[model samples]
Target chain A: MFSQRKFYTPYTSPTDPCPPIEVKSYETPPQLYLGFQPPCLPQYASAKEALHRGTLWPALYSPYESPYKRGDTGE
Target chain B: MWYYEKKLQYPVRVRECNPRLAKFLIEQYGGADGELAAALRYLNQRYSIPDKVIGLLTDIGTEEFAHLEMIATMVYKLTKDATPEQMKEAGLGAHYVNHDNALFYENASGTPWTASYIQAKGDPIADIYEDIAAEEKARATYQWIINMSDDPELNDGLKYLREREVVHSQRFREAAEILKEERGKKVFF
Candidate 1:
């Protein structure tokens, strides 16, 4: 038997009273019908930096240099 | 819209000449659940997907092209030095009879990869879920290939491809939840 077993019990949990439920106002869910919230973009030093991060445009901006930088040599 | 990358995404330096493995590897390049199917599926789906999710599709779809190259290169290297007798002995003669040692777009069973392997449902929810499923299938296929192979050179590449599938699935799940929530708030006057 571990001596630490008795020390593991938190005395507050069982003796704690049921917390009062705070009443909240009827909150309508956020909707595009009301307005739109765009995704928060990261701050970049420059356009090049953003492009390098591939955040501005992923398809057009490649993060790394092209693999086929050298001239095509047939096998 | 596409550029040829002469190099593979992952280096595949298979030292052994196993045409049989090459035949099986072809599935990853052009099979039903292959990288080509994934690339084509996501790229085509991008057109119909919501603007917010287009980037996700574009990024993943484009990356699939790199995987396609990696798998194709593996196949090429595996069979590059295989003799006709070796090819026949390895059961690659059927493929050889059709296209010889040159790479032809086909699955392990020699079925040509077709556009029908994927579809753009025009529904974001369905398409994104389908994308996740496709990734899972591709991951399983890579595991199958890894199981059959003892080559360390090949396993490294396969493991990388398999890990990518897990990441892609996670991204798709995020995209799906966003789409679902956005749809939930829709109302008619």
Candidate 2:
């Protein structure tokens, strides 16, 4: 003797609501500290002229000389 | 006026994105001591400055406009595909909750725009000093934002911004020196 059994599969709709999503929170790390040197003064004869004309100022000008003076010597 | 044209001092290329970092950079656009304020302050102040200092201020002021564009672009790219959920996750609470997908013009903390950020007193000496302080403040803010972001792409942009602040500060200092020299030569009663 043999026995037969019936089974049905339920249909899932294509437009069914999405299942709740579980998202893992991401932590933003603290920003790192870094030091930046100031911008370098452009070294050019014309820039030196501009310095003399008060149009440019070299970052490392000697305190003794007016920015306009032109000499390698600090004085 | 005879017209002359000049090209961009630096190339403006499309940069990579990290949406979270972009939101903070937006402060430079409309925030206190931001590029918009810097540009307006210099340009407006130039009017009352002596002829000697006016050109320098004008040139620098114009450059600030370019910087404003750069910041805005960085923000746009960062936020391009940002979903509301991601925005909220990124701690851009105000942007997500209030503006939806719209990018309203606001400061870093999402405050509305104001003219109080700019000051253009007629005195040239006063103006130049103000310019120096403004540049330093902007540099500091850039540093603070750069600290907050971990994205290298964002960091690159921030570094460039910070460098520009340094350069502008030096230029303004030079301008101040020029003003002081002129005042020194003036005959006083």
Candidate 3:
């Protein structure tokens, strides 16, 4: 007969807890870089406000004016 | 949901008709690392891409179709009205024997286009990285094509195509960063 798969059982309290691995990242991209900004949801009144609130994800924090916006209206 | 652009993203006005060069350039049209492959890969991947980045995928993928059309125009212009003797001398007689000056689906070296040239992994990170790589490869191909000829008309279009690849790579990079944040994955950019 083929071996039947057994369901995973809950861990007993006798085992040591798994240690967390900390990754330090200096290569993390910023909200704005080299005259370009990654796409961001315009939730914050300003990117300064988002940074003040400690929002770190780059895509969620755009700071540049989009060149694609229509200029005929002169915004 | 799409509107046709009456003009090419860049004009493929090849001043000289060179079947030999056309044979090489055709790879960018239908080869493994060609515009058609780029268009199909991104378009197919968009359905599985996160909703926020779907707009990026669709826009870039649609632009790839324009590049595809440009390549086709170049190939067609190069081969149209080419004499049978010219075709044979240019080592395209084998292609002419089969296609008779028509645009058949084949790479620069006459390999038939195949769907296996691309991937639709349905993973946003993986697919976007693949997209980025595709743009780089396409850009390199355009550069190699440019190096082979001094035709101003062809060079202008090829340079524009190469520049678009750089812009597309940047967009894909932005899209990947967005998807990473959306999915809460932490990795260096």
Give the winner by lDDT.
1
Which pairs clash in model 3? B27-B108
CA-based DockQ, model 3: 0.02
User: B14-43 in candidate 1: lDDT tens per residue?
Assistant: 868899898789889889999999998999
Indicate the residue-level lDDT of B148 in model 3. 76
- Candidate order (TM-score): 3, 1, 2
**Please, what are the lDDT tens digits per residue for candidate 3 over residues A14-57?**
45475421221111123224224535634656765443332333
Tens-place lDDT per residue, model 1, A8-66, is: 22234544577522221111111211122236634565876543243342221211111
Better of 2 and 3 by TM-score: 3
Alpha-carbon deviation at B65 in model 1, angstroms:
0.5
Instruction: Evaluate every candidate with DockQ and list the scores.
Output: 0.02, 0.02, 0.02
TM-score of each: 0.69, 0.65, 0.69
Per-residue lDDT tens digits for candidate 3, residues B129-182, read 898788778866776777676677777677667656756776787787777664
iRMS value of model 3? 14.2
